[model samples]
Target: MAFSGITTKFTRSLVIKMAAILKDRCLRRIFKKIDFVRKPLRLNFVTDNGQHSIDKLLVANRGEIACRVMETAKKLGIRTVAVFSDVDEQSKHVKMADEAYHIGPALARESYLKMDKIIDVAKRSQAQAIHPGYGFLSEKPEFAELCFKENVIFVGPPSSAIRDMGIKSTSKKIMSDAGVPIIKGYHGNDQSNERLKAEAEKIGYPIMLKAVRGGGGKGMRIVWKAEDFDDALESARRESLKSFNDDIMLVEKFVESPRHVEVQVFGDTFGNTVYLFERDCSVQRRHQKIIEEAPAPGISSEVRRKLGEAAVKAAKAVGYTGAGTVEFIMDKTHDFYFMEMNTRLQVEHPVTEMITGVDLVEWQLRIAAGERLPLLQSEIILNGYSFEARIYAEDPDNDFLPGAGPLVSLTTPLPSRLVRIETGVVQGDDVSVHYDPMIAKLVVWSKDRSSALRLLTHSLRQYNIVGLSTNLDFLINLSNHQEFRNGNVNTDFIQDYYNDLFPEKKSLSPDLLARASVYLILLEKRKQRKSFDDIISPWNLSSCFRVNSDLSRKISLNDGYSDVEILLSFENDDSFKIQIGDNVMKGFGNLEINGSQKLLKVTIDGVVSKLNVVEHNNTIYCFSMEGNYKVHRLIPSFIKSKCEAMNLGDAIAPMTGTIVKVNINNGQTVKEGDIVMIMEAMKMEHVICAPKDGLVENVYYAVGDTVERNSVLISYLKEDEKN
Candidate 1:
């Protein structure tokens, strides 16, 4: 069957059942060969050889992953060396490392991808080992080989293992030869476009043009029909060249709605291998995993066994040592096929750790030091459910475009059953364009998948990040999705439900806005008290600061929102409730007053929310959620008049960026929806269009010119004028 057809039939729920059947068959065979001396196998890789420890290690990567590796190393009393580019001088990884080295320029090719410079820094810092941290040199066989030749331990799989699995085409062949089920595709090396097209025809439509050396969905395209093949192929080839510097492309059957499941396997020098169970990474966007979970939901015991055995076979085929992941595509009919093997630690390793209670990094360090696997496959158990949501600095509403700017405010809820934020970047740290936009990994664990999903959704709602766009809303919606809750997932889940998941614009309710305004006013009042000692008066009993303002105000609220305005009458200093229309909202807060200023500290829905109010010109401007809004303030008459008088042809540039393309010319007649210009900002192209049918009066900027925010790019005359 075609890959897409096979994948479309596969769903996460059905794959779980298939996994159980496979597991049973494999285990039964193992029991047949079991003897007193060969009853399965228990491998111990850690030795009591006086506890060998490396003094310091260099993290050859940057960003969150580097910080994550350093955290574990630090816990084990190991120092860390951080390598940075000119742009990363103030990066979180650089700040976290005990020692740092400047590599080269901001571009990755000149720094992070430069293995020689990284090694030189390690040597200069006297580091004993180097941890690649899952990008750049993580899966590069040459890097491990160089580290081995230099006598520095590579804190991952051996060079031989990387060589076998790092190359996708070879990895697929190796897995297939070892009797592992693999996706039927043209793995041949014929890079000619004509040959690829012929191969795609053989494979059937809905084919995927993928780069031989691609990750993160950069050099991949899905062609649904023959007519789209040529365009997709060209695009895939161009992206592959830009991303991997390899124009070599391959034609594969595109899997439709197939679940992405991978088994975590560990091996040691003693030829012992064990599988640490599996993780479901089916929830994705643009071929990048957004949410990951371990002990995959809906998979029966039978299918789990099959996946584990196949994963083990795939690992053995490559002589894999240390930590690695064997990925597979499973359909709803329980059919499974190997995708590829990742010869390094995965970014979602934290999910596995949460479920298994094992530190994969520490084990990787031990294995690289010539140790053997410590636990047998039978000893490993799948425990509770865990979910990991990657918090990225991107605008989910804007096609998930990467967001870059300083993190002005970051607040995470307390770690509990509902929330746990594992982040490296702190407030004030700049999210640069030099690296991936991911800022943190938020993980939630529970006794079951449903509970875990609920906990994740609640936690995400409480997370507050300002100054940069994030995918928080998208994650929240995904967690609460009907398909997700039922374990119905696949790679195309995002695209399938993009419209329902995100709306063009979201507005706050008027009552919620009013409440937010009140909170902001109170918060500002508190701030004024702190800065000035004479803002509050102490002896006025009626106006004296009280702890329970909601009770005193007698405010009634209906369904958390109110339409009727009710007079707030304070009954006491600490307690008050406001009755808005027929609903009342009762709340209390700790009152602190300094001179004329007042402070109210309140807790709402088990989370602390503070409100500060300052009165100026009998109006309030509330500052909360990192955005400021004026409350009860009259609009400026002059500004309102000017807005009312402005014409429809007015144009303004959205942001500071380069004018990449000027599509319009002076005196050119354009329709209402005609594209006038295009600008490139923050690596995304934004098009400026005509507001109405009119003649182009002027073209303010030419291609290759830098423009500031709100700068006029083009202007149009009246619609009646035909050029």
Candidate 2:
């Protein structure tokens, strides 16, 4: 201090170290006395000039959303760190990250939802920011506050915003005060069952019981009658606790013909907020959107402007920043109401990005860095229509029962400038039951709605997944449905067209039989050729020389219930004659190979078709326009007898899951269709019911116990056999 101009290097270093030490100690003391979750602890660790630059980021989630965020971060020249559970070590996200840290076991609560573990990983990886993807700790105010305490940027809104918008009652009151049309509901402090029942009755039957703290259909149930109120509330509470750690709920009037329309809004620290137009997520199943499109199809220009303006108002009211969606429910007449604001990016944000020609994730990163809004509301332009079909590993025909296993064969539509494929698994990766069943999202864009729908359906058909049942075919049907094509969609769209969507199976086509027969016969000869080891190949592969007839064999295919005999005759090396019953047809088939693609091109009579054929688990999967089919051949009696058979009167778990509730007790009489057990799998519940009237002979599983698929949960004695 006495001779600043003549200061030595040792003295300069000593002074700088003391300043840093004192700053750290002073900040810690101040933070300790503050309630981080309820206050603005937003501090810039990298810069103080209001704009921050991040060199590395940690993704605090898994699966497709995690991968989605990393892709954008990488594009921005930012290195990414991935935190994965044990099961996700081999996940696509882990493989794509610059560094990956194993957090915990397969369960999300023990891994992704553990704030301390994620924050620790970020610190260990030297990440400057944490991007909590759409789920997990994304909406938790505490997680955001924790990031604040650590001086790491949480790429989301402030904790105050998350708290204000996360609770339904708080958000409703805020929106109502802001002149946003709010739906009538009970948002009170009373938590007793009697109080909730009274509130629901006041709201009328068909009331919606929703978790106050979370979104995405978790802890949401519809009580259609007074008798169902208690059960629905309990179910909502259980799911709420598992997903959000909050069981507080609010009552709301269930809207009919409710069209789910949401507008994407973005903001920055500079107080600039804008709407990126709206997406129509009206077509949904299981209270979650399966397909989403933008901009919404039929709203008038005036209504569209109002919708966007209202969304901006909602975002601005909370001093929001980063990517957020303001969801609204609209009636048939286009009258809209505020639903809730998602405190993070939505699963359907791709539709918004497609139409806006902007990378929302990149926007989120820039905003978190204290940068100004990328584009103003007036500067933003709506480009075209886009649709996102969420491909899931679930049985669509089985009430959308979720399944888990290795994706023995997985292929997606080739990504292009106009088409995007968001996924986190590969051909050999397993889709564990510990996470969501969504396998990938197929996003397609076009200049108009009709063109986009066509592209969406075309892409859906191109997606071929084997080893497990999927919603690929169901998505195809949904995209091509007349009502959907006409933009006549609502939350009840799936229920309204159930019959058309899940129709009774039509008789197998002779054309398909002819093509399948040719492929099989050729496959057999190829195997025979392989056995010769390229020595006696021609003789064994060639048709047996015949004087007056061709070699024939009866190819019988049994689809579990019915049997169809296909008389296959080898006409030549590649040509075949397949006759079913009295109908006969000629076809030729060949396997065309290009890179990793295998296309089975076949001609039946004068018609030609190409099918994606995959052989997995002894089943030939044929995926085509008609639908996905499992080709099965009759097993020998001895082989069938060797397989273990399940008891006739036993109710079994539909998939590998934990038994959450066992409704049946030993020796207890129950009627047919009564729920025997409830299992939780793939983040949802499924009920196992009695097949007929019977007395429970034994209880095979109990609550909180995990069971494999087809494991008997309850063994029943038939009514006639009960003593």
C-alpha lDDT (0 to 100) for residue 640 of candidate 2: 68
Q: What overall lDDT goes with each candidate model?
A: 0.72, 0.84
Root-mean-square deviation of Cα positions for candidate 2 versus the true structure, in angstroms: 9.9
| Residue-by-residue lDDT tens digits, candidate 1, 1-723 | 445755766765588989997786566444423311122112122223333346688999988888888887786677899999998898788989999999999778899999899889978988878899887899888899888777677888778778767567887888888999988889787778889999999999889887777777767888999988886786677666756677877778987889999999998877788888899999887678899998887889889999999998988877778889998998887678998788888989888877766778877766765655645676566668999999888777756766677776565657863355677688778877656778888988888989988888877765666666688778887888898899888887888888768755434344444354345434544565666666545532334543565323222222212223443444454444544446555544564556533344664323455544333443442333323333333335644654554644456676566676677788888888777777655434566777777677888899878777556677777656643
For 118-149, candidate 2 gives per-residue lDDT tens digits of 99998899898999988889999999999888
TM-score of each: 0.76, 0.90
Model 1 lDDT-worst window of ten? 35-44
The regions of model 1 sitting more than 4 angstroms off are 1-53, 416-420, 503-507, 523-722
Tell me how candidate 2 scores on lDDT.
0.84
Highest-scoring model, lDDT: 2
As a whole number from 0 to 100, the lDDT of residue 686 in candidate 1 is 61
Per TM-score, the best of the predicted structures is 2
